[model samples]
Target: MLKIRLKKKCKKLCHAVIAGICISGSLLTTSLLAAELGYPEKEELTFGFIKLTDMAPIAIAYEKGFFEDEGLYVTIEAQANWKVLLDGVIDGRLDGAHMLAGQPIAATIGYGTKAEIITPFSMDLNGNAITVSNEIWAQMKGNIPKQADGKPVHPIKADALKPVVEKYLDAGKPFNMGMVFPVSTHNYELRYWLAAGNIHPGFYAPHKGDTSGKINAQALLSVTPPPQMPATMEAGTIYGYCVGEPWNQQAVFKGIGVPVVTDYEIWKNNPEKVFGITKAFSEKYPNTTIRLTRALIRAAKWLDENDNANRPEAVKILSQSNYVGADREVIANSMTGTFEYEKGDKRAVPDFNVFFRYNATYPYYSDAIWYLTQMRRWGQISEDKPDSWYKDVAAKVYRPDIYMAAAQSLVADKLLLKSDFADLVDEDGYREPQKHFIDNIVYDGTAPNDYINKFKIGLKAGDKL
Candidate 1:
């Protein structure tokens, strides 16, 4: 009896061990699949953003539960200014933030602050405009030609404003203008417009310790926060300013200024803000990085899906006090596919705030190169660099590899169609040559040196301050 009982117990133990092994194998395969789908290593995240309509993606992701769908609990906070937002990301207080397209490139190249910040997402395109105070607008109106309907010709050029700037110079009054930041798209676009009309915006000489970009300026450009633009112009502190919406729209609503030219007119579909994070953050939390990017991509698609049918709802969310905090009417003026240049001059600018269409979310290396070219043009680089150097910096800062991985995962999950990302599958990370500047200067990003030399005003090869 004892022998028979012991034999029965051993048989039962053997069967139990076999069952355990089979379950372990099944779990191991499941874990591998989960890894392939990019399970988030860190779920709780805090992101920062400035109060601008271009920050709609971050807002939409949180409001729409896209982040929650990816197992990410996200908190979106508004920073006081761009500098604070950038510092929060650099110091790890915030995981990432909506950053000026130039911030990561400038930071990586040791322009303002030295940090290895990288962006896998370009937030939006063509959401900025140059606004001049009412007084200045009245001075420039006579120079601008009228259309058949008595409206000023669309894309009122800087040529109309040039004579006014010359008058300021002749009278020994400094013609001051406001850009949100030094390394901002507003600065470069404002400068490009001014230079195209034969007005010298100025140059920066950081090598000579003169970082004030007013070396030989015809119109002096200075920094002013976005929210303060209208008030500053109202106070007569600045004659004109270039900034992202709804600030420009706010100016029109308040009757303080008139938006002269949109950045879309300056350079059609130019890359704007980017979602930026530190390299260390990305390396330490690789899965989280891709997951967050995936969430943003989904949000961008939703924003632009159905020909922007969702934009009215998006504008309402952005108008909340916790987000952009502007009035709904003010925000909608630009967010809803139409921009009110003058208070009553509402025009259908359907592409004013592009989120996902035209591959606006892709972090193309050529976009990085374009910002670098502008940096060199304005004397921030203070030296000429080889085309290879431009390419190298672009590769370091714009991580399309991460972008593609996220895109592929989304397609696999059926959240995004493969056809939705057709340009992505075989992308070389460079945009085809762009030719839509207000001055009609064709930009070929592959030849940075040659493109820099083509500029009429700006440092070319072998030129330095």
Candidate 2:
């Protein structure tokens, strides 16, 4: 009786399997189907981010279903500060992070936390500005040439700000400035702006236990958290600050300060943030790494598609407490491509917050090299290095090969096209020497030392301030 029952059950299962296989023809390849299915290696993943508008890629990826389409279950968490966020990535608490472009380079070089962090995607470009308090703005307006509308003509050079700084100095008051972090783009951009105007933003002599960056400085620079920038300025602590939006725009809303110059004017379309992961994480889960990049790329395209028509919606989403937590109007001030200089003086500056267009998401070795060059230029490197050293360091930190693989996968999937990015056929990863700086200095990533030498101010090869 038992054998008869077993035979009957086996025959029934066999018949069902045969019918199912017949329903789906032999031409269907299960392996190819699985690849197209795009399931993530790890479904549940947490990504860490600092509270800034440039972190929009991560948020967009989650909200726009890009991550879901790729089978990535993601959670975006706001970190208290950069150090904590970087530490979270290093310790495996975060699978990856929204990071400063310099974070990977600084980490690989053993600047702050020694770990091999890699960036496959650049987040956005040109969303930062240098803002000054109301009193300082009053002083600076006298030095600047006014427009027909009584507003200062833009691309406001630090030259226009120098006189205000001097008056504070002559009054025996130290002019303090706030930046996000030591390895932050805000710090380098601020230093670049001030040095361009002949105002020394100072250097980091770590060998002498003087990381204070106030060494031989006309402006005393310090690290203030991003959200605290407006309040710090309002409290009369920092006279001015350089930071990513919407903090700069927050000052304009509060009527506390005027945003003097944008980083877009300081250096055109400068690389800002990057999506970073530990070398260990990438090596341990290579497929997961590529999958995440694909999701982010798609999200970036969605954000910038239709000429940023979606930004107002993005601003609303980011205004939620879980993300940036700033008000909608404040976030939109910069996110929507116009910035408020003085209260009710909003001007059209469409490139203020760039997400995807113009190859903004491609991690360039040249961008990494530029930050490294600035580090050496400002004594953060604390020693001399050859040009090859810069290239090697950039290669190790910025993984353009990984980026191309992800981009190609998107192209193959019909989600994106080749024309959306730079002509990568003969691409050598280095941008042609950029000459749009406020100081009019031409920067060739190929010749970092020569660029350093051109600067009248700043540390040169084999020299320390």
Candidate 3:
């Protein structure tokens, strides 16, 4: 099969064996791989992911044979947590992995681990939501406005949880919350939602060796892995949590919690996970880097094609133990176009798990800066930085140059349409000023420092701890 596929691919490349041979239906290699046209430099690869539905691109690429179509054999493994997954990539144990959008940026900036990690693909968007325990939601539900049918109004603000937080504060008890990781989109999104409602989610002053992020917080936020969120909240360890799909929906399945607000309502169409590789890896195996990205993009396109008609199948793939490993109905609860905020209160949220729509696969510079702005806002950056610094960091980590190369190749192969990437023609990386934040504050990535100052609870310019 490899021989036949290689023969077809080689015929297209004009007999450029390009360093690999079909010896007795097996692959043998010469060092001249990817020398001229498009053969991948490194073929056998392993990728890592967390147990979340947003890891769909990697799963789809493998299951749909997109990687095999590129003449690459791939392995997909689920790491225990984000840190282990990141460490695997930082070292060479794993070629690349699905990563938090902030992970690559934070690594490049020496926040946790220092590495020149870059992402050519942004995996998906708007797949996360915040859920509170049934007790907390019971208190919050009373404050929320109801519709004509007595169902709670959506895009529920954190303001309703303010009185609950105050009740805990008034009792001299800490109001604890869980986020996936300190630099995760969940962390920033939860912080953004909390701070918007005058509930201080606290700051991280790394200069003072405080990574706890709860210095002045009214609601103390901590890390609880995505899979453990429902159990953790149910155990009364944390009152609420912000995490990606299957978990938030898991709570509803268990009748333990209710999803209060989605990240879509917090910040619409926000960039979520990224496919990250070390800079050395890209430089050492340029063609391999691009090929994997192409597979991911192809998979992303299939996932969101025809207005997510493919989602039900994708959910089946995710429900497998090798993937998300959640119950099919539970995974489909959110992945199938409707999110149940509370049990039996399913609402149409078709955009809940966006894979390729809205150019979700594109590695936009503005998206990188938005995460950077959140880091600065929450004091993870610890010091003020100029807008130029933000731009430079974003460019260093978010490599659209590589993304465009993969996208263009797909266009030339006619697997994807040129119209699909019309935005790439004269693209300047930065997006227009985003105006749909839950707080009604506009986020202009071009002027990050100015955007930071507009926030009421966050660290502003020169406002160090």
Candidate 4:
């Protein structure tokens, strides 16, 4: 028996050396988790966006390659507005953009162009509304208040356009309106719906040099850009505006205007737009800023996963011709939920255009302290700070520790699922106090000057301007 075939050929060479040491310890544990997801030290990125539809998670992470599956190769351009996309992400010709949750807290509190800018990600929430002109909705349709089928009932309050802006200031007329910038979240939701209808939508003495927020007035507002907001109110020049999304469904599809109200009825789930950069481009591309925020959190979880059913293929890739060129039925009337208001009144606003359900791409330091308490209740932060300076300028412009280190490296590469980020694992980055405004008040972001002293119409607590 040749010594029993040499002990079965030495037990077949000791089971092929223990199966090659368990496949080299499973490829060195996937090369140390791909060196702890740290390969992109900067990989050909461009990014910038303005043409709206909530810039759909940077155009669905550059049309779904999810920035080449985190190896990154993004480009995405389109920007003729939001101050040339926050001056092309503060002069680097945009390595990041799609901004305006008050353009990185009014460019990190210096008010306009002083940039330290940061926003790890919080793009998409209620898309925005407030259109007007069809002669100010037929003089605000006889002070709106109808329901038992007369129609105009929903959330249409700015207290019914304050007696048609006090009958155009008793016919002396300078009522104007439009807001796309001046540190826009459409200029603080059109100055919080014209100061919740008492109407003095003015101020911003900018310490007396008056950056023309029309010092002590009643609805002057300005700046227009958003695809020339319905051709600047169909050429009469801004009778009303507060944009976002196919320019308020291209002013109810060109009958020229009438959206009336929908920053989710002014505050329910607020926080609109963010993804800015330039805090030295996230400290010189820390793993290319967590691999482009893990390819915009997997393109905002594939644009709010199944419930949106990929939003008619992301409203046919934001109506093509280079993202949000509008008209794919005016961006599916509201990126496929339903919102037409006043041209055959469509309704079911399924969270309007929230690119990812409630954690809506979490960058919540109470949504940057409710946009820095609406930039200190709209004198654009000219004074009264210290609610610990609004939580240290909302933890230095809402980083959320680089959005939970790109959502915990996409839940350790299982490509997301840790209950798809259980409220971003121990999120103390505030929230929970928001009570949905349009005047019901209650904001709390750990008390921003007692929510700017409960705005009975802006500035409080030793008010200035």
Candidate 5:
């Protein structure tokens, strides 16, 4: 059971409910089963998140006593949007946050807000899907291939959406779409899917004060918060959007849109949100950082354990008004290993919200590099950077050292099996050349420039704004 001793140091300690657990002023738990990793320097911490199901790890960590187990008293807050969440972490108002994968990388490289944000944990994988409004879907559905039973073929690509976009363009109409943030996985994934289908989603040209991302675009894309995506599209503010779970699922339940594609289809097992904190915070509170990472890792394990036997419970926690606040049915639609596309067309997608499995929690340099490559491709980077630049920036932001420190401690403490991380042995912080992308292009993170140059619709090497 990974036994540890709680050292009694209470002079006037009283029980107080924290994330539904009563604790002794957040006492330090000493290791009686393994070597003590040292106590957290700062225990009372507040983390921020957007109300998406991908923020489940932070919620699970607190709800399942994982945070309390590490002697950390944690408060989880739902921010207004991605920008506010990142701002909170930067201004020390938030200890950390469930941030977009590109947020930390963009911050480190001075794309948007300049900061030294770092991530020791990659939260979850492949929870996002692209949804088109009912009007757009009606136009797109006719072009999509169908199965024998008359269901639309799975992994419905942007190719199906291409004709509808072209029709709008032919009529001299602006086909607008929404993504969560400028640097969000949703934005990049939407861009990737649109571009792969020969549709121009457009560029940023951020070097020339053109952050609108619609220079010569076939479909104009803009930032909308995750929770607001469906409503915005319903109002016809956008024709479609790419966003995370419950929200995409919400569109189906509300009968306003149909999710045409999931990011898993665009790029299989793609990296999603990350647990982000300032680089200075990690160095200043080394023990606290590792302990918090450990708690998160364990929470991820529990959530993905037994082929997601814990997801219904997780959906309950996430459905609470303070968390994701979506209905349990909507959250469960994706969280429970199946996703509804066209209404009544739910399909099995077991890897839709992978957490601990496939080494999903480990903060890989390759993952960071992939996000950087997307940024450069979409003109968010505004200029060419060498392969080494990508590698250096990845190393600066994605800290596997902290992740491993926490993971090894869990193994030593007998919480997780060593076999659980077999792929990490002699790891060079990069995955092998991944070929699962829907475009049929292989991405070797070791060579970012080569990958960027392979794209047809966006910026490449030496392609200046």
Candidate 6:
């Protein structure tokens, strides 16, 4: 009887162990599913950005506690340049970054440092300008029409700078201009404005290793880091440049240059920077991606709400050395709904820097297509592609579906109202053909080939260098 009792006790112990194993398996499955559906696999994230006004989304997200609300611990760091920012995101030193709209698109297409980079959030719209040195400004003043107040009329066009460029050319000097990066929106916008005014901003023949963008050119364009723009112009390296604020405002404050035209005049409310990450990162951390996007969306809204009453505070925050590091007054000059043209000619021009309203944060496919077309026009693409190719590329680079997933999660959590975003259920991720360019060229994302063919100044269908 004792032997039989001991054997029964051993059997009961084995049964308990098996039951525990079964229960643990079920719990593990449930946790994995929960993790896959929507919980940040990694909560602590670092995002990279340049020290410019367009990096506001990343800064605002951290300052407003939006990331913390979404259960994400986020740190924003300033990168030295565009390439460094992209490299940081790719190597995982940064989870993501504030990027040019073209960076992800170009990277995906194997343009530079090939990678499948993607953006779910676009950062802001139209915070760039074409500023010229004080001497150049003096020359341009004679060409510009003066207003009743004895100051130059606002929305100063590239026309005023045309004669100045001509004078430099006639004098056998290189008419130098600065843009932030090769794949930057600033580059294309500056080129567009100059080309529209009948100036050859030059072409890039990357096929021949002439990527300096000075082929058949009237003005020679070069890269100048944004923070160094004012000093560079003062040193007479570049006569004028197109850059984002508050660097342009810095030029005004330092008395080195005067801003002649704003990007708003180049293309009204044009898409600027975007929050970029690798496609692999988004796929690996889907939940984290959505949560991060939601935090950014909230931060963007806070920036433009109430006709920008929050801008002064934002300027102060951004002025800290750890952030943009520009002077508060210099940053506030443009951040507070007023822009200075000449040194003392400050004027109210609201909507100069839009962070959220008008769906600025959404990564629309049309926005991607615009940059792609610019690439093609400038010879970075190197070959002709069909309209469908442009569309497919736009779809790959701009992931509005990912953006909507984040928006929906925010709405479900009651952190945001359903009315706060574009109608995601019906959003086709394309803007109607835009016609507000200074050249008055109509751009339709669906017919990219046709748009390319319409340009008289750029490479057209079946054209090769």
Candidate 4 CA-lDDT value: 0.80
* Model 5 pairs in collision: none
Estimated TM-score for each candidate: 0.93, 0.92, 0.94, 0.36, 0.94, 0.91
lDDT of 2: 0.84
lDDT of each: 0.89, 0.84, 0.90, 0.80, 0.88, 0.83
Q: In model 1, what are the clashing residue pairs, if there are any?
A: none
TM-score of 4: 0.36
Task: Identify the superior model by TM-score, candidate 1 or candidate 5.
Answer: 5
Cα lDDT of model 2 by residue, 1-465, tens digit: 000001111112112222222222332222342265344567568898888988888888888777755546677778988998899899998889999898889999999789999999999989999999999888888888889988788878889888888988999999999999998899999999999889998889988888888888999999999999999999999999999888998898888999988999999999999999998888877778888998899888888889899998899988987788899999998888788887777888898888887788888788999999889888888988999999999999888888887888777777888787647656678988898898999999999888888899898878965
**C-alpha root-mean-square deviation, each candidate:** 10.1, 8.2, 4.2, 18.9, 4.7, 10.4
| 110: Cα error in model 1, Å | 0.2
lDDT of 3 by residue, 1-465 (tens): 001121233322223465565644556563332343367788778888999999999989988889876767777788989999999999998899999999999999999889999999999999999999999998999999999999998889999999999999999999999999999999999999998999999989899999999888899999998999999999999999999989999999999999999999999899999999999999999988888989999999999899889999999988988789999999999998999998999999999988887889999999999999999998899888989999999999999999998988888777899998987788788989999889999988899999999988998999899
Tens digits of per-residue lDDT for model 4, 93-135: 7788788887887778777688899888888788888888898
417: Cα error in model 4, Å: 18
Q: How would you encode candidate 6's per-residue C-alpha lDDT over 1-465 as one tens digit per residue?
A: 000011111112112222221232342122333343456677678888888987887777887777755556666777888898898898999889989888999999988789999999999999999999989988889888888888887667778888999999999999999999999998998888888877888788777877888877897889988998888899999999989999999988888898888988888889999999889999888888888898899888889988898898899988987778899999999988988888888888798999988788899999999999999998888899988898899999999998888787777666678888745568788888888888789888888888888876877877777
On the 0 to 100 scale, the lDDT of residue 242 in model 4 is 91
On residues 1-465, what C-alpha lDDT tens digit does candidate 5 reach at each position? 111122323433233322222344564434553236876778778899888999999888887788877768777788998888899999999999999999999999999899999999999999999999999888888897889998888778888888888888899999999998998899999999998889998888887999999988999998888889889999999999999988999999999999989999989999999999999899899989999999999999999999899999999988988888999999999999998999998899999999989899989999999999988888888777878999999999999999998888889888888987778868889999999999999999899899998988888777877
Q: Can you list the residue pairs that collide in candidate 3?
A: none
* lDDT string, candidate 1, 1-465, tens digits: 000011111112112222221222342122332457656678678898888999999988887878866657677778888899899899998899999999999999999899999999999999999999999999999998999998899888999999999999999999999999999999999999999998999999999999899999999999999999999999999999999999999999999999989999999999999999999999999989988899899999999999999999999998988888899999999988898987799999999999999999999999999999999999999998999999999999999999998998888878899988997888999999999999998999899999999888999999988
Worst 10-residue stretch by lDDT in candidate 1? 1-10
Per-residue lDDT value at 328 in model 1? 98
